[model samples]
Target chain A: MFGPFRLTNPLSGGLLWKIPWRLSRHQKYRQRERLRKVDSIVATLDTALARQGESMRKLVRWKAEMPTEEEMLPKDKYTVFDRKVKRYRKAIHKLPKWTRVSQRLNPPGF
Target chain B: MPYFRITLMRSGIGLPEKTQGVLKALGLRKRMTTVYHPVTSSVAGQIMRIKELVDVKEVGTALNKKQMREARRPAPGYYVERRGTAELEPPQ
Candidate 1:
């Protein structure tokens, strides 16, 4: 036979516990919104980068297999690929650099 | 000074020779290999060449090989709370 006694729950109520439910709900919502924005940005960048990488790879393969001077293609053809390469290079440069420091960590003037 | 924390995320197995050369020049010999370099135009150019194959972050400090190794090491699950007196006993 066991004796019965009511056990008081130490964690049932506290000032610290009450504040977080309201504060954390709003904080979590904001965090999720920020994360979603970041995810979309990253997804877009990844797609663009992947496309650029594929085009660059194709160009490299074409250049590698292209004819030598003795068996050259037309001047316009060579120049077209050259222009494409230049454009790809420029686009790569134009894409934002992946350096993103947290605002809190960044220096005052940076 | 700002340093680039570059990790090779993909292999250069089928990539162009020049791309592979750039990876080698960056001191990244294999996938997941990391290297650090001072932030400079030259380093930026090198990274641009293989940007698609790398993950990069600008960090405030560069870690040496030993420090990098230590950073990747896992925490020990157990800790010794007391020392044993086995050494104090005579050889038996």
Candidate 2:
């Protein structure tokens, strides 16, 4: 009687135990995928920073070519340029903080 | 009221269906999406189910979607300083 009961137990070596094992394996795979995504976000942000830097340089060049401060481009144009520069600087400052946050969440070798 | 600031740091892909359901219930449809809920045991339990996939913070106030986006935005770097057409005229 004991032998038969032991054979039927879910914890006993059988197909039933595979369910939890499979579930855990899937979880691990998902975790890895998520970690990879964090890295991808960091990479894309780096490229964004490079692109923003180029645009900022172009804006500075245009500003330098102007004859005088009073004769600078229209107010709207100046505002737009200022906005872009501010956005770029803000992104540059924020990206590092985001990277650090992500790193803390997943950690290296995690 | 105190709130939990939950940001999805990871996706639920390839995970068990139930785990994915928990994320959806939390209103986290994509990575980096954040949501806030008042501190409660029910919400805490939901968070625990997917705790590995999110970063949680406690805050005194919750920010709406627009405020959250603006918080991430940067400021403009320069001011007009001054504006006048007379300065452009030829010196007399």
Best by TM-score: 1
* Candidate 2 local lDDT, B1-92, one digit each (tens): 66778889868887778989999999999999999987655665576567557777767799999999999999878888677887898899
Angstrom error at residue B21, model 2: 0.6
Clashing pairs for predicted structure model 1, backbone only = none
Give per-residue CA lDDT, model 2, range A6-106, as digits (tens): 65657566556423211244543443454454444333333333443422343234235422323323221112222345332222112322222222211
DockQ of each: 0.02, 0.01
Give a tens-digit lDDT track for model 1, residues B1-92.
66778888768776678989999999999999999987665665676567557777767799999999999899989998866787687897
User: CAPRI verdict on model 2?
Assistant: incorrect
lDDT of 2: 0.54
TM-score of each: 0.42, 0.41
What does candidate 1's lDDT look like per residue over A1-110, in tens digits?
22354433434354333322122345434434433433333333334334434234433442365332334322211122213443322211122321221111111221
- What range of 10 consecutive residues in model 2 chain A has the weakest lDDT sum? A99-108
Where is the poorest 10-residue window by lDDT in model 2 chain B? B39-48
Docking class of 1: incorrect
